[model samples]
Target: MERKLAAILAADIAGYSALMEVDEAGTFQRVRAGHQELLEPEIQKHNGRIFKLMGDGLLAEFGSVVDAVECAAALQRGMAERNAIGSESNPLQIRIGINFGEVIVEGEDRYGEGVNIAARLQALADPGGICVSGKVGKEVGSKLAFAFEPMGDQRLKNITEPIACYRVNFDRGSPDRVEPHLRNGYPTHKKTSIAVLPFSNMSGDPEQEYFSDGITEDIITDLSKISNLHVVARNTTFTYKGRPVKVQQVAQELGVTFLLEGSVRKVGARVRVTGQLVDGRDGSHLWAERYDRELTDIFAIQDEIAHAIIEQLKVRLLPDEKVAISATPTEDVEAYTYYLRGRQFLHMCSKSYMLLARRMFAKASEIDPDYARAHAGIALCDSVLHSWRYADVSIETILATSAKALELDPDLADAHAARGLGLQYGGQREQAAAEFKLALALDPDLHEANYFFARFFFEEGDFERAAELFEKATQVRSDDYRSAVLLTCVYLALGRRADMKRAGLLGLERAERELTLHPENSSPAQLGALALAYLGERDRAKEWAARTLAIDPDDLNAMYNIACAYLHMGEHEPALDLLEKVIPIASVHRFWWSTDPDLDPIRNHPRYKRLVERTTLASP
Candidate 1:
């Protein structure tokens, strides 16, 4: 004997006794035919096994609770449509119950209290409706597009405890219909919220994990182009990777109303993918599909899945979204895989990793020169190298690469984002803002574009707009440490003391943990120092600032922090001396010193005014 957790679906024909009394032979014949022609086939198609059938009822087992509930709803809907056409006396209807629990399996049949409870629940269900146990509702809620109205706790005859029950409602047109679109337990009618979880790697080879991960990211990028959806970025969704997650939990954590989960398996030249669209409010399956295709046609599979999900969710795909879904980077599967691998490496965020990423992108482009994403990757790599001063690549080379990427695919959001950053650093402020706006228009959920746009606004002294963009960026990538830290600065600038304190604490915690992990990196230490300075903790701020300069003496931001701390402490001589050191470096790098509100206190000082004039004239 073995025991396993499964979703138990129990259903029976409503008013079967009365119908049988009216016409025994005719009623039995119709009931049997309906089960065979409609209900049985749907159950089997949804991967449910009929364990037993007693007169006008059925007991089935399903691997997924969501599938079980969805199958039951489909069966009930079908029966409703059939009843609408028949005479009132012969009207057909079904009552369904679903529960998730462990059951004893002896041979082909399952037995236990779980099975009995499901049967009792079916009796409680209204005709053409479903009743689910509390446990089942919890697991499937947030993954399915159905409403669950609480029926309160009921005292079952043989059960010791009162069983909590919920009634499944699929009638979206009714006022009592509970909206299934909810994020973090709040109902939202807006179509702009979505979460794409990491796709399961069903590929036999463990090394091919990057391929599956890359495909998930590509789909996310395509969907984010819709602009109306608040798509959570990869960083936030990837946090649930390899973890046991319920659809509702994912929705809550990512602040998204819908969830997309899928698995990819590759066998030689052929690939298979299975995907499901789930309502994150009540754990209901909206749509599910399986695709089998040659490796060369893998892109088609992704497009088909996206289209199916959008249609099932009743989302009107914008013209841009449709175009984005249909767009193919390359026909060669190998080149696409390389491009995906490059993206994975780039996420590691290191100089060496970026160089390797560049090589892979170059290889992908060589295999297919018209692969827009690969070209964009190349442009981004070059731009990062120039920004970080990690390579001796000339500005002309960086600009030329970005231009080529844009020329190949003018609508490529990543290329636009990279070009924007390049332009901003090149002193073309208006051009940079335009490029950033274009990138956001192309992909509203592109976290980097939103973040850099906020940075651009903040640098241009538009604090209000910068704060709004920063908030949007945080929604896109909630766990982004830099964004959290930047929010602290924004709150401080706006004089929102409570928000400033909260943000400062968060930034300090993240920076301290990051520094603990990578003791050699000065970036987190510098950020921590700035956070401390903002919090008015002068001594701790000075300590971290000293540590930052000790690690990287040329770190201009750290030097600025030191000068600011002295200015705040009213140590004018020391502050003037530190500013003298930073002014020359700021001049060389064209850093925006005047726009920084941190230095406002000393702005009117003759020494500071002179230093600003000297730095601006020399740099300009």
Candidate 2:
């Protein structure tokens, strides 16, 4: 019952009914000769499965989409050769539409829109030409040397969603027409934006949850690679996981034209996945499909789901979109399983989970030495652990793992981001910036790079640029308290009272919301204190700071927030006293510690100068 994507080719004779009316016996002979001499041989040669054969045409499926399209072109060219040799007749011609999509397999027959779309495409094809949906074009567009003419968007019969079409130009007189590459800018032509919600885990076992989440992330990653579409980052999308989502509301919140939601259930070696795309403007279903596949085919299933979603979005694929969507770090199911587990635990943002994630990533990389993503996961785990102040490993370990990841896959954005953070910590500022820039260039939607790079910018006393990045990071994931808290401080440093208040309230709201999620966590209390300090709530600021310190006595972030509160209360002595206590933490870096307006009351203090000097001396 597992559904797999196949290239469906629907073809029909150009004038079958008319040909039969003119000369029944002769037409039947001509058609039978074309079917046997041309169609069947080409189908067999290309490894195509002919599922249905009408008297005039046939429906075929191919595992390789490239082979299907090539076979069709070859068939046409061969038929032309026959017509040229047979001087008495105008050769019989056929119309074709090739589509790459998911097909539901019920016994020997394939069902679903995968075949239906091809049928619709066939109706649109010219007598001697082929029409390919965006779905098929994305897979074989750049792979084939044949030029394609843009057919634009067509609302075909019985198809609710308009199909973006292209015609393969094989004739010598028509020069191959190439569509202009979509340059990313404001108000892009790709008007239909979408946010794919994290797929729900329908499996009863909690451990299989990562499988569902992994599928969701893979779909998001693939969708994001399409140059035309705007896709929300994983951080923002997963916030709604396990929560009841109102599609229209989510679409409005995410500022998307569509919302994709689904569920995944894996039992033993098999999995069932269901997904639906909804139009955001009005809560109406646009496309829905179900995929049942064995566990080993998870990567292929992911590619299919991503392709299906992109097809529904009607986006013209970028030149690299096909490769990006199809790429998998490892073919080994066990290694892939371990990698998914690593990714699942990594996103939880806890030190113990991070450690577990690191171990899982190491195991995955060990099993598949060429696994680029597993190496990237290891790099991220090392960086997050150190940055979160649970530095179980040394700087060299972090550097080595990050370097190994980059060596394995220089194009991996996560590796570049991790290496950037390592270099930033190692005192190579310019090198760190270059790495961060490269990471962003590799994946502009990567929020980790934006967050870490913003920290690097903010720490160097560039409040304006730092604010810009923090704004972007928070936009990507507003519930991230660390980003909100830091953004609040950046505004404080720049002495923008109105902006500072706004950012502080944002921090306060995030911190307060997080209290419900992780009450024992110290970050919420620390952020709450900073937020209160800026809003002129001295008592609340002091209380939250005290609460944070009580939760974790070694919480330098709490101490810093307490210092900020004291500074606002005009108590220079205690602010300086708190600063002196936390100054020795090796990972702490605040160029604004001396220059920030909020810290001005303590800047002239004798202890402040010594603390700054100690940081300078300790910095590598």
Top-lDDT structure, candidate number: 2
State each model's CA lDDT, in order.
Answer: 0.74, 0.75
Off by over 4 Å in 2: 1-195, 201-213, 226-259, 265-272, 279-287, 291-297, 307-323, 332-357, 384-396, 555-578, 604-606
In the order shown, the candidates' Cα RMSDs to the true structure are 20.3, 21.9
Q: Candidate 1: misplaced stretches above 4 Å?
A: 1-195, 200-213, 222-244, 248-258, 262-326, 331-368, 377-396, 513-520, 538-543, 546-585, 588-611
Model 1, residue 165: C-alpha shift (Å): 28
How far is 481's C-alpha from truth in model 2 (Å)? Answer: 1.7
For model 2, give the 10-residue run with minimal summed lDDT. Answer: 180-189
Q: Which candidate number would show the highest TM-score if scored against the true structure? A: 2
Measured on C-alpha atoms, candidate 2 has an lDDT of 0.75
Per-model TM-score on C-alpha atoms: 0.54, 0.61
Residue 312 displacement in candidate 2 (angstroms): 6.5
